[model samples]
Target: MESAARNISFKEKANKALGIVPEDAIISKSYLFVSFIALLVGGVLGLLQGLNRAGLLELPLWFNYYQVLTAHGILLILVFTAFFTIGYFYAVLSHTLDGLLPKVRKMAWIGFGLKIFGFVLAVIPIIMNEASVMFTFYPPLAAHPVFYIGLVFIVVGVWMCAFGSFIQVANWRKRNKGEHVPILSYFATGVFVLLFFGSVPVAIEVFMIIPWALGWVETINVMLSRTLFWAFGHTLVNIWYLTAISAWYVVVPKVIGGRRFSDTLTRLVIIMLVVLNIPGGFHHQIVDPGITESVKFLHVFMSLAIGFPSLMTAYAMFSVFEKTAKKKGGKGVFAWFKKLPWGDVRFLAPMIAMIAFIPGGAGGIAQSTNQLNQVAHNTMWVVGHFHLTLGTTAVLTFFGISYWLVPFISKRVLTPAINKLGVIQTIFWTVGMIFMAGAMHWVGLLGSPRRTSYTTYSDHATALGWDPYLFFLAIGGTLLMIGIIIQVYAVIHLMFFAPKGETEFPIAEVEENATKTPYWTERWGVIIVIMLLVIAMGYVIPLVEMIVNAPPGSPPYSPW
Candidate 1:
């Protein structure tokens, strides 16, 4: 290994130190391609949805509204976000730790294969309208057995890759005693760790639902199943937020020419996130029956606790930007903001996403509040909130990441045209989200239901009054779809068509040296125990109630 390392070229040597190689890069790129493809499919579906919801278009017999909506939700959130995050984590693990072993490479391939197979299973059922249960799959409105099975495969397959990468990091820990793991890897580990535990309920949900869907069971308890599903659902989106924040922590400082605030502080925030995000899912089920008030209140408390880290992140992000701008001779409060690299698509795209999170995060807290949640639950306001956070914040960051990652992995120079296109895409997306999501928020407060076609809503006076806002939603969706197309084009041009060259992968920012991270933060035992206790406090009673007072299980009924 030593001899081989010495024989490599300068760039290869740098890559070696980072623990990545051309082959590993290829593995990461493949994951990214899946993300891009999903973005394309999901984005188009979103446009169709917007049009349908505005009463501007009718669904043909072949393609009904619900199927397209189901497909859109699954593709964008499940396929695009999950695949993209895994791929990005692979890169982070390789670069921040030791480059992956050949064994780990094989593990990745196996994981990839499983996911692809699962995706095929999932999509075929959705396309056939046998799985038009929507993304929630709220059983009683049962999909084909294949839909549940496909979901299990996806969950497990992604879990496999997450587990594999974590093992590699663990091995690295064994070899390097008394050293702090790199921040990016630590962040990646936190994400997957949350996923590992958060996914249990989903795995159980799928396992149970599949048998029921297949008619192997007489019925399934609907409320119990919803509790189980939501146990994983909101946490899943939190994983996306953590991943995006990790990206910002690792890359934004470099982009703005600053240093990471403090390693100890950052680790603490991540630890807080992992522990608090788990029980946070309960807030989503506040309106659902079979859960007690005290337990629901506990869930609300946990949700508020999770918000602290987001607040911490916000402080750190703006501080880094401020310091960077000041270093370039800025004065006065907020004056530094103008000096940021706004012209750089790589920086601008995510910065805007982060900016959107300020509002998105607030809405999250509001929705989690048992009092205010009465207003937001199951409304278009909920839709608007997620659009701001996951859609704009997370999805936009993913697009920004692709701007540099494509070139970095493809061994190509990103042409100026591609960069310009990316900036244009971001603009289109930001404007689109404002019009679309803003309208959703307004109409939701006025009592508009989410997830139904506009034509159906036309029977009511309030629904008829929503026409102007619906137009805004349709227009916004159109712009956002165009943005997705432009982004896909930019990546394709960079990867396969752009001239071969070199671009530096953005590594974490640190000032020369650090003393050390807190020992408690590094130890899994401390965080794990606290997490478990908090989770128990929020969950045990409510779940027990669900099992005991649960109504008779509902037999699966096929809508198709």
Candidate 2:
């Protein structure tokens, strides 16, 4: 089979007509523009929340924090992450599949238009202080009908992109029959499956519940809606993180200059993510009064089962890094770590991603245990754990991948000085998050709660213990904001002021003897994902039933 990377050279006649701009570069730049706008909106909301938490600003008495939180969560997690991932995948697939994007130019514009319209509709009620429900869509706390409708529109736009990518892959497969999909594309498709299946329940829940909440419907079952919403929400984060893992698989090896130590292990990790990721949402409800013990335990076990894939990924990637470093003349068990390019943005991105995963993984395990969850549920500990995983690791790595891929995708030359600045900003982000999240864990474990704007200690002794941690968190927040600003500036410079120059398209050289799977096996991967989703949701239904049928005074649904 002809490698896509090996076949990307343009004919001289086409080059003469089109100049240096590749079709993929055009698509990537358009998406980057959209992502930056979303980030700006999300950042403003995040800054406001941080200020409110620190007592630096007083909101109107009638203005609740829930709407702002919802906007921030959706803008950052859904809009920004989805746009970036779409762009990145498009860029990679165009290269790996060795095909020109026939319709991505039109698709990008369409996606941007739908997204902008949806975002505006969603934010209007939020800014007007009319809808204060948080992003979780938890039952009994609803927002304006437009908010749900707008969100559905935004998701629909994303689904279009997913469908477009699938078309691209399918077309590529048709043109190049008998060829195996690249590992990265295979994993990227797995992410798309996760997103597509997960979005189904979310769409159903929002369309059903939003109208009822707004009195457009006479009656609706809030409990049933909550069950469905989480069916989507829990898997949503997994979809985001799986992309991060895919990026890691592509990136870590390149930075270290070696192949993934175990291709089978990598495939298994992707399989496990598809299998174990969705059913584990029940662990989120361990403390809820309505859920049954058996159901919660089942979730706990499934959550723990996800660890196998995580461990496999860590082992395979780290082994490749070690081997690469050793080949570069490093010695000893840990001495090769020092040979790593700590200051390079490309290297530091994956390295810090792995570092953040360590704490995130540990915290996830601790939280999944029934006994341990009793102490940490609804506390800042949960906040800290996710910030490390999603905020620092996933977001930072996405930024890093953009920095590395954007120049190639744009077919332009970015200032090396700006690239260096971007790396510094990434470091600041990693360090600041470490400090902030560590402090949050400490304070939360010491009994400080989450989701409140103010904390009033029960006694002087408790206040004394908590105050310093809060202070450190404030400082860390400042650092993180500054780092974010630096990144934003760097991106702006790259997009507008970067010099245009002729450059070689990045060509990935594969070993001639590289192990390859059959085409049929790759197509069967989709069937496997369908099976996993069925099993995961099937397991959750029994839990949902128990919660719905619980007695009024039972501990499962008690308000206390």
Candidate 3:
């Protein structure tokens, strides 16, 4: 078997292999640049937020703790992750759609403009402490009207990006009759569809809240607000998870020298995710008043349904991994793991992230289980667990994608040193998260609350005991900052200094292409209809009761 890589420069391989042209690369680079900037800012806020919780780093008179917390959550989870997903998937779908139409490209740019403008509008108020409602915006504690309006623009931006893909896919399907959607595009379409579905409730919430924040409405229903927020919130995280799943099916296999696990099964899981994703948000409000136990139980059951798709993918990942290793001349069951491409940042980042999900999934189970939610509610345990899922699983996978993605977009090559830097960054990140997650989980069991400065209670004996764990948190947080800073430097280096060159994308080998793919795979209209029907069955009864027999809205609470 002669090497396919032989006699091929990276530039030649990329040019020959990828469907992208210079224009496509340029558009993606714009999104990547802003995403990195947001990550750097959010990364700093995260470090400070952690240290503040540990009773270190007193803020300047200009800054308030709650505002920083709000900014941290909003920027990283919403801006950074969302923009990256939009950008990454655009690139993925563009190839399959035979290059995005010029109008679609224009719409995406317009969307990006709104996102940046919206971020500017919102973040200024946050910096000045005028909008410190926290990311959940649990109302009665209202933000400046600008905050809601800014967020609305962000949502609109997301919609524009999403619909752009929809138009491209619909157009492609129209021109090429009876064609099976390519595998990556299939998953990307699923992400966009669910995102559109998730945004509706959020849009309505923002509409109601903005007027309330401006004093048009005398009161805001805190419970109702929280309920609506989570409706789309869980789906947002699921969208992030689905984007990673796309990598798992397509990119991961290629980077690790394996073919995709199973095309039909992968398509089925993507469909299952879309149909089952929404409506589980009710479980987040298990302890809130007015929602009945029966309804909560129903939500818990539906929330648990999400695990089915995840478990199915888990089976496929393990199978593909083991089979790939066996083909590489490895023997025995566990021994096959050694054949994976550990040194490649593309593989390492997501691998660590997937490993982190095991613990994150456990945390989710703890938080979602109606009974277990009591033990872990509002504790650092939940906070620690949430970090594992998004911070590690999603963010780390994004990091892996960034390694090659930025260079490919910028027409630059990653030097050997930068590649080595990514590996080291992953190590620092994994170790640091272990320390933080371990400390938080331990202290949470001791009844330490999340989102508080425990230093304020240092005079008490129980509070004094938290110092060691707090110390661990500070150490872990500092290391995490180092990891983020290294990546920030890596991104900047590639953007500005790395030598000009083209880079190749790792498009995974397909296992087999049966002459005919399942036609149901392309029947997205039917699937979405079924999803709406299932979701209505779960939500209508609970939500109708809350609206029809409404509680008096809660009076506003302004702490500052």
TM-score of predicted structure 3 = 0.95
Q: Could you give candidate 3's per-residue lDDT for residues 322-411 as a string of tens digits?
A: 888899987886887888888988899999998898888877877888777888888888778877898898889888888877887677
Q: Report how far residue 456 has shifted in candidate 3, in Å.
A: 4.0
Top candidate on lDDT is: 1
TM-score of each: 0.95, 0.89, 0.95
Worst 10 residues of 2 by lDDT: 551-560
- CA shift of 253, model 1, Å: 0.5
Q: What's the lDDT of the predicted structure labeled candidate 2?
A: 0.70
lDDT per residue, candidate 2, 289-316, as tens digits? 5566776776777778777788887876
Q: What is the lDDT of residue 447 in candidate 1?
A: 79
Provide the global lDDT of candidate 3 against the true structure: 0.83
Error of 2 at 532 (Å): 4.7
Note the Cα lDDT for every prediction shown: 0.84, 0.70, 0.83
Q: Write the per-residue lDDT of candidate 1 for residues 1-560, one digit (tens) a residue.
A: 47533633454567734434778888899999988989998999999999998889999868999999999999988899988988888887776666777777788878898899998999898899888898989778999888878888888887888788878888888977876777888988898888888888889888888888888889898887887788789789889999898878878787677788778888998898888877787787888877778777766678788888888999988888887899998889977778888888889889999999989998888888787889878888888888999999998888888887888788887788888888999999999999999988887887778888666443778778888888898999998999999988898888799987877667655665655677777787678788888778767888788788878899988766
Cα displacement (Å) at residue 162, model 2: 1.3
